[model samples]
Target: MCSNYDACTKPERLRMYFGVEPPPRIKSQVWPLYEAPFIRRHPHKDVGDDAVPAREAVAGLFGLIPHWAGEMTFGRRTYNARSETVAEKPSFRDAWRNGLHCIVPVECIYEPDWRGGKAMPTRIQRKDGKPIGIAGLWTSNTKATGDEVFSFTMLTVNADDHALFKHFHKPGDEKRMVVILREDQYDEWLDAPASRSMDFMRQFPAELLMATAEPDRGKKTR
Candidate 1:
């Protein structure tokens, strides 16, 4: 539930860390990241619209693969393609067929509490400015150019202790959070599946996350 991040007030910080510029206007109730064209730094590699990596795992925009595609809208259905059942659902089954692979580069994600007296906004981020990748599933969407445009959904699993203890999540519900991956886990998550996916996901350390409140701009730190 680390959703309360407002303005990317630290634009200069983002630029320094990401090496790419921040959004022209730093805003969004829910931030938007899209597939755009880019040239990679590696002189030997190819760079183009299809080559650009996604900024964040924007849920559901990317559909599941091997689509039976019986007249379904992409946006509504694609938002959450869970890891546990990706192999079972018809929509995602084929995606799981060859094994779905995707990465969502997230700044932060927020969640609200309807039962609370006053809603609190918290901003969660790594202490270091290292850009992290959240695991996801992707399908190839065709664009006018005929180059395969890939859209993906970030995977979510039960929240760890930090989140449950932070006054978020349903009382008894295991509740879910986006699956943020450690650098070491990327290969398996984006490569192997079914057998290895669950095992690799469990490797995340519970102690790495610090979920807390964002106080007023002065005096206190989030």
Candidate 2:
């Protein structure tokens, strides 16, 4: 699962790439619960049957906040919802069935390799360094204070057989990676029915992937 990532896209680039208006400037890096932009169909308030889904860019927290959550802290652990069980998991099932699909724009994602008795942070991205659109589910919550919280969780699939992805996570843990949609597949992914959405959950070609080892700044000092 991804604990942090780089999603720093400029407003103009967001418009150029996703065709939606830009959200607020995101930091160079984003962590769980940090707000970031996502492309998704806007919630329609029109009562008419003529209403259509409109694509829009909106800022939402990286972690999902199920409407049933009594508090926001639960988001910390829901940043990623496994694709295999998302349709059945209580936290994500509702959104999954309701077609709350979203696309998370990521420049790169960070993971920890615990092979040498300690974790080494690795940055994974497309070989060309272009932003990748990760498939995700989003939901909204209203706080007691009248504030509304919009959040999302990236969907991941097993990547055990993937040459590149299988190298990131801890040794004994299951290998998994976020579902990255090709540019041509974005529209289909966003508009597909819930029943057909999972059909798009598959491993990306490792040939297009690249990785770099980085110092683990979060590692404790002696």
Candidate 3:
């Protein structure tokens, strides 16, 4: 599960890679509950069904807030939804059944490597050094104060058989990875129906990914 990641906040990269404009402000590094940009199909009403632009970028919390959530804190544990149970999980089913698909533009995702008997932070990114679009679901919630809040959750798939991702997490725990969609599949993912959404929940090729150890220097006490 991806609990930490860097958001792609560069306006030029957001436009050239995701084909959407950047939000006014977004955190460079995002954790659960942090606001970040996500791309989804523009509402038909806004485009009159004949507009040229098909996608739009909107800022939303990194964690998904289910409609039934009594408080925003509920999102902390929902930042990553298992693809296998997303369609049935109470926290994610509504967004899945409604096809509220979205693409999370990420600079890189942080994972733990425990090969050396200790957890080492690893930064994974495309081999070509380009931003990646991760598959996710987005939802809108109304607070008691009558304010609307948008949130999203990244979709993850089993990675036991994946060459690279199979090494993440712990030595014995089942490995998992986020679904990184190909550039050509971004539109298809956003437009696919709920039934067909599963077809895009597969793992990205290992060869296209590169990982390097990036231990947290801030953790060292003076």
Give per-residue CA lDDT, model 3, range 125-215, as digits (tens).
9999899999999999886225788899999999999999998888889999999999999989999999899999998999999999998
Pairs with steric clashes in candidate 1: 3-110, 57-104, 60-78, 60-79, 62-151
Model 1 lDDT tens row, 48-119: 565554232222233332343433344335555566776787767666566656554455545543236554
Poorly placed runs, candidate 1 (over 4 Å): 1-66, 70-72, 113-115, 142-149, 160-166, 212-222
**Which digits, one per residue and each the tens of the lDDT, describe model 2 over residues 1-222?**
887888747776666667667677455578887878888976662434444435677888888988878788778899999998999999899989988899998888898877667788888889986788999999888862257888899999998899988887777789999999998888888888898988989999989988888875463211
Global CA lDDT computed for model 3: 0.91
lDDT of each candidate versus the true structure: 0.47, 0.83, 0.91
The residue pairs in collision within model 3 are: none
Per-model TM values vs. the true structure? 0.59, 0.89, 0.94
Model 3 ranges off by over 4 Å: 45-52, 217-222
For this target, which candidate reaches the highest TM-score against the unseen true structure?
3
Question: Which residue pairs clash in candidate 2?
Answer: none
